[model samples]
Target: MSTPGGQWRNRETFVREGDGIVDLLTCKWAREHEYRLTKEVWAFRENRIAVHFAYEWHDEKGRWFRSCGNENWESDENGLMRRRVASINDLPIDIGASLFHWPQGRLPDDHHPGLSVLGL
Candidate 1:
């Protein structure tokens, strides 16, 4: 999703182990205003799918903020996200860093968060 007034109509999705290319666009739910995935780390364990990701967003006032955490996603044979349970941490970055993507030609700066260096 998205914010009530942000109008985040553009988006893309990537399936695991599938090219890793983010060219598939799907934004039917773009008007939801209050749901999204920020830092997704996932894996399969037996019959379940586990996920960990950070969620950062803005309030109705347009103030950007973040909450970091992990989650559990269970699916049926079709591999769809279902029955999600999660926990959230309220800690924001102690350092004011500019998050970036170096692989996309963004250069390293003193404020870099290093996610790009780790190939995230």
Candidate 2:
């Protein structure tokens, strides 16, 4: 599957384990700065979930952007995500208009409204 930063790789080629997924995430995060993400589950069923997510980040040049997307995920019997499909769009935003204001890492649990309530 193609990730947000235009990294296109066949998900099937990678082993369906946490290591491969973590590698991909590490690479993605390494290229992104001040990244913050939020996801809201829209639907869920046995071994499958539908979610809408948004992430905010700034480029090396300090250009800020908000990437929004919807993803559908399928998991194996062990609850490991075996497949994921996502469609995303990026929009530029002024720094002053940015919504995510937490630290540079994982957001805190008390951060309310998330992307959905903020109409991201």
Candidate 3:
């Protein structure tokens, strides 16, 4: 059984799962970042693991965002995560805010704040 990582897979699979959002991101950020995880709170059954974790991501410049909240994983017998569901509110820091933060074209930071603007 193949484990499910955050948007990790071949291009075709990603397109199928991602609803053709036109995302240029490769599989670079697929797996869970271990350093962010504060603890594995509990495991109710062999198939279910409850955990508390801090999740963060860096932009192209390597500036990491504030660690976010916990997420849960429910795996099959093979320990492959078949179902991953998490309710993430929002982190306080806006050091790196996604373009979606605004209404498509209303960002105060030059109307677009991303790699293209920074000229990565």
Candidate 4:
């Protein structure tokens, strides 16, 4: 999850599948206003995948932010992620400068593939 100061933290246990879902829910709740995310696969081999992602959102006071990150995921035989490590950086952006223009949800298939396409 991300903090108000732009720090990321592993606040939930990943010992069980349910725990991850709960953590996601909690994190979403913590972020306010028009959250949109896009992720692209960077590489993959066997049970591991590397991804790059960017998300745009606003705070309660309508301050906009763009967060970019890279994640490494390791999955079990069932294709469930067993381990995930992420490094992220958040930058404040003006609303007009934001790149994620989709409505507040999943990006459409026709949207740009990743941050590189948008030069984010």
How high is the CA lDDT of each candidate model? 0.40, 0.74, 0.42, 0.71
User: Which of candidates 2 and 4 is the stronger one according to lDDT?
Assistant: 2
For model 3, how does the per-residue alpha-carbon lDDT over 1-120 read when each residue is reduced to its tens digit?
A: 334333323323433223332242333354322123223364566677666544344555545453534456666667765555554433434545522343422234544444333332
The candidate 1 region of ten consecutive residues with least summed lDDT is: 1-10
In candidate 1, what are the lDDT values of residues 6-102, reduced to their tens digit? 1111122223321221222223223222333334456778546666554444444544444555666555455544344555564433224414223
Instruction: Summarize candidate 4's per-residue lDDT along 1-120 as a digit string, tens digits.
Output: 221222222333233345545666576668757888898899999988999888888988889988888888777676666666677788999999988777767689885556787775
For residue 69, model 1's alpha carbon misses the true position, in angstroms, by 0.6
Error of 3 at 39 (Å): 3.3
Candidates, ranked, TM-score: 4, 2, 1, 3
Q: Which stretches of candidate 3 lie over 4 Å from their true place?
A: 1-37, 61-64, 90-120
Each candidate's root-mean-square deviation in Å?
A: 11.4, 5.6, 14.2, 6.3
**Each prediction's TM-score versus the true structure:** 0.44, 0.76, 0.41, 0.77
Instruction: Tell me how many clashing residue pairs each candidate has.
Output: 2, 0, 0, 0
The candidate that achieves the highest lDDT relative to the unseen native structure: 2
Total backbone clashes of model 2?
A: 0
Error of 4 at 61 (Å): 1.7
